[model samples]
Target: MASKLIHAIYKDDDLVLQAVKQIRDARYHIGEVYTPFPVHGIDKAMGLAPTRLAICSFLYGITGLTVAVLMMNFMMIQDWPQDIGGKPSFHFYQNMPTFVPIMFELTVFFAAHLMVITFYMRSKLWPFRKAENPDPRTTDDHFLIEVDASDHNVDKLTDFLYNTGAAEIKLIEN
Candidate 1:
């Protein structure tokens, strides 16, 4: 099936943000926005739901912590029980303070790496993936807002986009 969309180009991030708010306030359905850099609060302006990446990060961190604890316990307490610098390795609880650094580092490592992987998966971004932006200029200096033009009057939408300070407008059919 083919669809029609209006691409509104803005030169400044602030203008794009304002245009997004105006578009939403005017009851227009925005398909997406492509910008050169992250615009703070653009997701809120677009009425997008909050992300759950933080929850994923927390779970990954817990997994790392558990692995660190188990590995430390097995290697230090169970596998080769030893006395180093007068600190006994017979009990995990008694020697937990010495393992704190490992636990913390592993937890952070897992959270950061896994969160990045989760974000890439969630965004469907991977190596050799084709770029989806309609305008390549959006990757450099411009911001583009894609509006669904299916059920709306194209002329009116163009006028609205112009009023919202769009530097350029294009109607694309897909």
Candidate 2:
């Protein structure tokens, strides 16, 4: 079955933001939004919840920190206990300051790399994947809001979008 969508095109981010708020206020379901750049406050206007990526990053950092401590403990304490600079390698606490830089580096490395991977996986932006933008102009200078028109009167929705400052309106079936 083909789903119908109304693509409302706006020339400016502000115009699209305003249209999104108005459309949501009118109780219309928005399928998606495509824009040349990130629009400020569009997520709030579209009534989206806050993302939990930060929490994931924090957890990843903690995991990295744990891994670093374990690796250092195994290598320096259990594997090869070397007494360098009169510091005992058997006790991890005695030489903890020397491993601080490595621990910090590993924590940041894991958090940043894993966060990026998580973001890509969550967004489904795999390599060689096709784009989902209905209008190519959205990749340039336009902002497009896809309003679900399957359950609504298309004529009324189109009129409402036009009045909400859409420069171009398109009815698409997908």
Candidate 3:
């Protein structure tokens, strides 16, 4: 059997948020929501867990720091010990001050770059991926809530959405 979805379109963010809360309260499943931009507190309203991207960023930063330390140690101390201005480079600890800048830069670089890649991969936004927005207006000035209507009364759901301030409602089968 084809699954039916109700697209409840709203003109304002507050209306969409309120509708989402009411629908969830009424025990109707919300498939997804599309907004012109980020909507604050939407994740909590959608009952989504907090993301772990920060932990990934920290690990990436630590990896970069370790790489920087090892590379500097190998190059300056083990590979070629130089004596410029009588400043000995015999030990990494002794030349640690000079490597501080590189360490900091590498840590930030790794954290930032890896976080971007992680975000893209997690969001399934790989290169050349097709857009998934149900309506072009959602990318401009509209908000959309996709409610699951497979086992529900479509007329009642449509009426409920209209009562919840949906500017437009579309019934789609998938």
Candidate 4:
């Protein structure tokens, strides 16, 4: 089914919170909210699920660390096996101090690159990505709420918005 958006352009944080409260009171479904900056208590007002990004980030970091360790160990011990400068050949783990720099570099390299890619993917942000915002001003100045109306009364929705201090309200098909 095609999604619908009940778009409201709010003037300030107060208006945003007021709308959020109205929506909660009426028990309306909200799809997403767009704001130039965070509105304090907005999430609580919307009753949004806490983001899982932190868990995903930690998992990605651990994966990067594992990759780094495996690659470094494979290259240094198995690939070349160089006895350069008379360093231990078979078990460099004896001194192990020498491999610290390589391990650190690989870990940092993998973590930095992988984290960037993972974050972008998780956010669905990529190059040439043009987002659909009903009012460009919302991206700069206004606060916006995009509510998902589920076969409900449009007049009632507008009435709720009016009561909640929404400066402007429009509907968009998403």
What order do you get sorting by lDDT, best first?
A: 1, 3, 2, 4
Note the Cα lDDT for every prediction shown.
0.95, 0.93, 0.94, 0.78
RMSD per candidate (Å) reads: 1.0, 1.3, 1.0, 3.3
Error of 1 at 147 (Å): 0.4
Q: Which stretches of candidate 2 lie over 4 Å from their true place?
A: none
lDDT of 2 by residue, 52-168 (tens): 999999999999999999999999999999988898886899889999999999999999999999999999999999987788998999999999999989999999999999999
Clashing pairs in 4: none
Clashes of each: 0, 0, 0, 0
lDDT per residue, candidate 4, 45-133, as tens digits? 88877887666666666776677667767777878777769876686475368767766676667667777888789788999999876
Order of models, best TM-score first: 1, 3, 2, 4
Task: Write down the RMSD of candidate 3 (Cα, Å).
Answer: 1.0
lDDT of 3 by residue, 1-174 (tens): 999999999999988889989999889999999999999988888888999999999999999999999998998899988997788997899889888999999999999999999999999999998999899999999999999999999999999999999999999998
How many clashing residue pairs are found in candidate 1? Answer: 0
- Residue pairs with colliding backbones in model 1 are none
The weakest ten consecutive residues by lDDT in model 2 span 83-92
Can you give the TM-score per candidate against the true fold?
0.97, 0.94, 0.96, 0.74
In candidate 1, position 18 carries an lDDT of 97
